[model samples]
Target: MSPFRKVPAYCRQSRTPIPFRQKQNEGLEALNTPLGAPRPGATRRKPAERAVARTIESDDADSLRAGRRRLGVVLKPAAQARSRNKLERLLEVGLEMMNEIGFDRMRVVDIAERAGCSTGAFYQRFADKEALLEALAQRFAEKAWTLLDTMLIPERFEGQPFAVVVRRMVVVMVRLASAHAVLLREVVRASLRDMRTWTYFSAMRDHMMARLFEVAGHYPEVTDKAAPGGPIELAVQIILSSLISRSLADQRIIAISDDDYAAELATLMIRYLVIDDAPWDAALSPTVD
Candidate 1:
């Protein structure tokens, strides 16, 4: 015998009625509803809950963009005068805050407040604190490069004795280091935590090394030691490290005075690189008749 059960026609018709599907239609309608609108047959979310949802969505979007930015995204500079001023103000305030409380403790909200802007404005330019720091690091790198390029030109030291040139170079380096001492110290600390920071500083070091090599080429004694990764490179590294350490360290605790430290560093470079005469000195000296 076939075991088959037949539904009553009336019950079958009731099951397929339009009203029964209306609930399902309402659910679909709810899914299609735009944000900030109430769903059919559903209670509206509280204002706080709606706000939290918006915040989450906004943050998620910002985070995705920030992640992309962290991975070598290039942000465009502001072209409008007002935007440029705001950007500069934000950076200046951020630097001051970072110096005062250090990067780890610095807050974007505080930076915005100090700059007379909103946190939203800060995020518009810098995706996050790390991005802000990267900007500052780039700024410092550019300034340092400009200073080194101007000061280390071979022609500038053409007639000067080698020791005098070394002293002048050391003074320029010291001035640069001292001017950005706090920011650099923060950068050093950030480098310990962030690979981007480390990469930036490493690039700066490489650039300065290249410039030093160019300058060293003008002196035979230094040039003789200037083979790639040679003693001249080592000496340059030592001079850079010493200047950075002195700038970041507490002067009161250090045994040497600033002048003495600068002099010693200059002497160290002079002796290490054996820069005794300018490249033109031998030619420029009066020949015996």
Candidate 2:
């Protein structure tokens, strides 16, 4: 009676359609089969392709190792630079404290404070005030050696004129003294009163003179045959004695200009050592009484 109606078929079927279910089973079997297993259209990897893949993987590992090594090298300098910066900061603070408060008045606390660090940091960098002073002295020694190398080294003066070499050397010495006047003055004062300080200064002096002797003696112009003992000792004694004498005498004088002092000392030196055209060997050899 309703507008929408259901229809029923009363026809009898001879057998249930088992073939339809079998076909569905076959389709599911196909679905469960491994892909690219001798299939009609699927592709499979060849032995050569597998070998290529292994080679690529090996190359990738090697490239990664090379990259890490290069990165390590690049990072190494950054670490060193940071360490150097910290050391420089410590040295700068220590030097500043010494200049402002005087070495005797400078304390580990003050230096560390100035450097924005703990006193422990100062200890890590320097054992004590004396150690810092020694470090400063070593720096000066290296610089002095560099200057000496320019003028006195055999290779540098191989074909140079003796007069030119001597003039340049005197200038270098004066410049070094001027630049290090404060440190030198402090050392000189301490050396006059303290045996330990004197020994330290004497050791440094001897070391420098030994090098000078070696270089000067090597020069063709000042060979051992021409100058005997080594010009190094003679030069050191003359320079040191003159410097000490002038410094003492200046203390007695009210005020003497640097020019006047230098001229006086130079004149005395030339009179004593440069008067005669002495053989290079005689000039360099050990000093006489």
Candidate 3:
């Protein structure tokens, strides 16, 4: 049986009234009456009433933005360029302030001041500092990926030894980490305390590992066990562990080049993945279907 029923015509008519003279008359009366207390010649809104009047008159984001813009308190770019320019400027200012004051100490007001706007303008663009930080993290990650993509050439791997492929991949990762040290440091810190950061890193790390396993699958000579316990696991552990260790060690040593770390890590990984003195076909037999 149907639980819902159509309303009877009379019930519908009673619930939803057809607007006529009653609403029209009320509207006309409102327009004719003075909003505040009427005076002899001029209707003078009281001081409190006047403030309320002004509040109601300009009670919107656009109005507040316009007011600030008119006072030269904010930058008012065209709508087409507004979002892009505002976000870029916020990230630039936020990062600088974060570096100087630390993330927790940096306030939205400080960011707004650096941005040459008010707190209202900053809030209009970002809900809070964390949201702004997330945007910066995402942008930095994208830039890092672009750097890695440019350095890693898959075609170079086709005829070369697996050792060469491993070298190039590790070198690229180290270089990328070097290029974005500030971003990486902040993201790592944020990832430790922030759930959103954890989710992003976890997904990105898993996806990259998944791709490595897929590529490893193409070369059956590489492994017998499933990743990340196979050849790919050794590579992943070497790359991540060495990168982290080198970053910490460099703070003490101050002369650790990414190339040196890459070369060393790459050699170790190659020693692990490559079979010594065994022919490729003999070393890894295709699993029988």
Candidate 4:
């Protein structure tokens, strides 16, 4: 009925006697000695003491394994501060080399040489040139997001006119783009060929879009059209694209000066996001003297 057989009591009990040995006899003799009385040689530790010693050994082994796990691949900042600094120097050297020779042409040995470290040291931090590039990209992304956070605060533009806010935003965006033009160019180029690079860009774009949406919500004109496909999203995409393209392009090819371009772009965006009654041509056209 139970679909199982019960074990006999004798079968469950261990009946085989342990073989006697010289070590066992010595241990027994040590236990038989009187407490606090000296023995002829080394006395055997008590079972409880032995167990505690084993537990301590086991705990130490476990702690070592955990430390190795934490320190794997990446250097620990606290325990390995010098290693972390070496890694950072490698990245810095790699970034400079990338800017000079482009990512594909850059080599790990060159980076190490420039950093005044060995190739072994480079491998100790990064697995390869691509790994170092990824670290550079991550560093750039963190800095760009930090700059975005400071510039895109809606409260900073509170009570200001839409044109004033757009002007400030465009100025900051253009300035940041110009400052990181070389690194951003490499990142954009890598994104076109590498899925990981593309994913990083996509995630950053999504975060920026979300922030832009939040800022757009402050204005009723922009908020009115803030559905799935919205003018706010389109405006953000166009503004960012324009800034990036301009930053990556030679300045000589552009007809307008940087200041004029920034001003016109800001006015164009403000007109699109606000000024509901103005016609498209009238809003975008230059005023006659």
Best-performing candidate as measured by TM-score: 1
Candidate 1 residue lDDT tens string, 1-289: 6487433332355565345356567668888899887665678889999999998887765655532333122553454678778987988898888768888888888899999999988887888888888888887777767766776777877756666666766666666666677877877777778778657667877877787678778877667776678986787689888766875788676776444566777778777765573222222221211
lDDT against the true structure, per candidate, is 0.70, 0.54, 0.60, 0.66
Alpha carbon lDDT of residue 126, candidate 2? 69
- The lDDT leader among the candidates is 1
Query: Using alpha carbons, what is the TM-score of model 3?
Result: 0.59
Clash pairs (backbone) in predicted model 3:
none
Which regions of candidate 3 deviate over 4 angstroms?
A: 1-79, 99-101, 146-156, 223-226, 245-250, 275-289
Measured over all alpha carbons after superposition, the RMSD of each candidate to the real structure, in angstroms, is: 11.6, 20.1, 15.5, 15.2
Ranking by TM-score: 1, 4, 3, 2
For candidate 3, write residues 202-230 as lDDT tens digits.
Answer: 55556566655555555557746337666
Candidate order by lDDT, decreasing, is 1, 4, 3, 2
Candidate 4 residue-wise lDDT, 5-124, digit = tens:
543233236864444455467679899999998886768999999999998887765666432322113433324667667777887788778768877888777888989899998776
The CA lDDT at 39 in model 4 is: 85
For candidate 3, the 10 contiguous residues with the lowest summed lDDT are 280-289
Cα displacement (Å) at residue 15, model 4: 20
Clashes by residue pair, model 1: none
The pairs that clash in candidate 4 are none
Candidate 4 residue runs with Cα over 4 Å from true position: 1-79, 255-259, 274-289
